[model samples]
Target: MYQMLVDLTKPKTIRGHVDVVERSDAGTVTSKGKKKKRSRKKNGRTSSGVGSDEKLNQGVDESVDGCTIGKLFVSNRVIAMGSNGTIVFEGTYDGCRVAVKRLVKAVAFEVNLNLRISDNHPNIVRLYGTESDQNFWYLALERCTCSLNDLIQRPTVSEDQAKEVKVPKVMLWTDKGYPSTILVELMRDVVSGLVHLHGLGMFNQDLKPQNVLIFKEGPLRAKLSDLGISKRLVEDKSSLGDHATGKFSIPIPIQIVYCFNPIAQYLISLAVTGCGSSGWQAPLLNELQMRAVDMFSLGCVLFYCMTGGGHPLGDRLECDNNIVKQSKVDLFVVEHIPEAVDLLSCLFNTVAELRPKASEVLNHPLFWDSDTRLWFLHDVSDRLKLEERKANSDILKALESVSSLAFGTKWNRKMGRAFLKHIGKYRQYNYDSVHDLVRVVRNQLNHYSELPLEIQKILGPGNEGFDGYFRSRYPKLLMEVYKVMHQFCREEERLNKYFKGSVV
Candidate 1:
């Protein structure tokens, strides 16, 4: 839907749309116009961008208590949170000790993707009710004190401190010692929660330390909180009209706003997007689009955890820029300086391709334990050896012949020779090693060639000046040898066909 809303910042009418056609306010709504700029992470750097839009409110409201939607009360409970005030309330619901929430009054929802959370996913914060009669609307929720973000802020913890302590997955790498079984299990629950949410086609668009909570008084479980901006993937919503109304008679066209069940409100300032901290956004979310946004956030969260809350990407990124700023496929696994550096390099890449996928990340060398690491190394070595054999064979044949040279120009000849020397520069005396390296180079080349011309230019082919400089540079001898081998194979096949010789 085309929404012409006044840009509260610049005071001009700007347009935006929902990715899906929506008929009501609760339907999935995304902007329809030009997209906002997204920041990036590269090198081992961080900035204030991570916590840029954090709200300044303490959780203290007696309007509604735990599990009771319309219940009212009054409380002076106030607690300190990361640079803000937090409200803590204790109450009984259904004869069980329950914690209730009191957060800042929410004017807009904060998340990148679109998904609705209606009492789904066990690890997610369950919404019990909302209060909307008077001064302000209050969201009543089951409370927990352990935010992953808060846990990571500690300066450092000794191995013993971590023995039974549950740490966020994002901070696991910072404390090298293996997390306790309970910790690992809890982290896996977090992943499982994500899997469940995503499986239902829902994306927790807003993910950060604060949004992820660990239950302090029960089960030692982690739960995702904050659904202010959660979206629900709906079918055709265009029929609901330009201002489709849903369960609470809310306007449908505005994209950034989030509500559980809301009443009508004239569009004021557009809803603000909250990309938890600069280091928190993911490489995939540079554009702040939906699925990719959540993916980008996940990457950043992973980086922060590995580095013990250290920021990976410095914060901002231009759309058009080289994706790879690190050596090897350090897209995942960020431990030690190199791992963190590599991951920091890729986690917030302006381009989504530069970031590793969830599957690749799960099995990355950085996450692998000693056993898995050894196995990965072994597999990589075997593949390299097979490649080396092919390289050596080509080199040997090239060293033998002179010139059929249908390819290079006089200028090309000089450049090609230099290319050959450059290629051979990693002087390995072992023929097997030479062949393996050649194979590796070919695989890398093929991978690059398959990418778009635009992407290739940014990544720079790693071929340096070698790619087009040589006409697929041949060891003059290898060219001749291949020709002969081709003829011999053909002749042998012909003979077999005619004489009924061996099929081989």
Candidate 2:
């Protein structure tokens, strides 16, 4: 994607800067010099519109040859049509896939360029350049496979109608949920983008699921696009008061309204009236309070992720009625992952001032291990290296299997509580305690065949078939347990070895 943007921005020739002319009201066509002739292509229509081909045309103030409004990019197909009558075409520029947005309003070009031209972040969509013809303004943007909203609804939706339809089944808890790691990474991307935007004193007033694009070509990269409703915060009275500076009046469609909470609806009304989505808008939206607005929107996003596309406030009709009668949002009760529910509580604090900043949210225990160390900071490389070292070692493999099977006893309803109580002593430990726990666990595994009756029930009545299956899989699980314990012990050793008092 970056390579495509570079290609779009590259200077094609050494010609002097050309004066950009609005062809419809054109008067003068200047040349670089008397020696080089300047002429417009007659009767030739470029992909955008019928116009004279000025090969060395200027984009903004800079001269970029081989990039004419009509000939620079070739349109393949119309990928999507925005609710505001805008159209997006899948186009190719210099062999790179690009999404060319045919904006209905000319202001869109300025809106996009203002927020994204100098800003470059993986989590934020990249804008290549802008152009205009007689009817529409064309923007060259990075092509994304689909929107986050679409990806979330894909499992239950049919491909034929998937592009244009909504599926409620996506919100069902019984469905196969997205991996926890992916959800965490997606949230990280949103926070990272918000960190950059807020640092520059700007806020995306309308941050919603549809505005978040998903790039599936490589990683499941979530980028915040569509900055038409974003605004810059300055030191002034206008910043403090809500005077509708950066409100998007695009009416929220019935099928796509995710945020129907009363507070969100009220704020949306204050900014813009007449049928529009307010799902991502801050509860008490003060344009001056930039970071808080973004944090509130992020909280809504996190809630959606955690609940598998369930709206934080409620369904559309419920939110509409709740707005008139209800004072508080009925938060979803997450049974499987209470940690995520706790984080969401902080994010959705009624007092916007009390909400945690994006950086603070990133550091929350929701992203950390049982020991409070962040999962992303773990030395995965070391783990990979350790696994490679013991790949061919039979003794290590056997030990790993034994440990895993021993832990498997917890899956049984009858023995699970006993297993929990037994492991409680080893859950938190000092260097000496860790060593002792490892020794105890290792010794306990030595008598694996004569396991307690409670655990043996889960492994199935002792039989040749059951024994064979358990023997085949237990070593791998045991190895995983050993590696985790060993890593924790080694980390403590390193801390004590290098910094004498650090171990405490």
Candidate of highest lDDT: 2
What C-alpha lDDT, on a 0 to 100 scale, does residue 208 get in candidate 2? 75
Candidate 2 stretches with Cα past 4 Å from truth are: 1-71, 74-76, 117-119, 159-179, 235-276, 285-288, 320-326, 369-504
Task: Give the range where candidate 2 is weakest over 10 consecutive residues by summed lDDT.
Answer: 18-27
Those runs of model 1 whose alpha carbons end farther than 4 Å from true positions after fitting are 1-74, 79-88, 102-119, 128-140, 156-189, 216-220, 235-279, 282-288, 315-347, 353-504
Write the residue-wise lDDT of candidate 2 on 1-504 in tens digits. 767554544423213221211111111223332122333222233222223232223221111112345333423345677756777764433323456677766466446544454247888877665656666667767666567777676765686555443222223232223234565667667777776776666677677788887665344667887776566667522333335463434366621342655444564454553222455555544343556767767877777766657776777656544433423655644533434655677776766667776766665544432222211113222333354466574433443444423334432222245543553544542222222223333433444476666554544543422332332333223223333444443355422222221111
Candidate 1 TM-score, true structure as reference: 0.42
CA shift at 161, candidate 1, in angstroms? 15
Model 1, 339: alpha-carbon shift in Å? 7.5
lDDT of 2: 0.49
Residue 151, candidate 2: how far off, in angstroms? 1.2
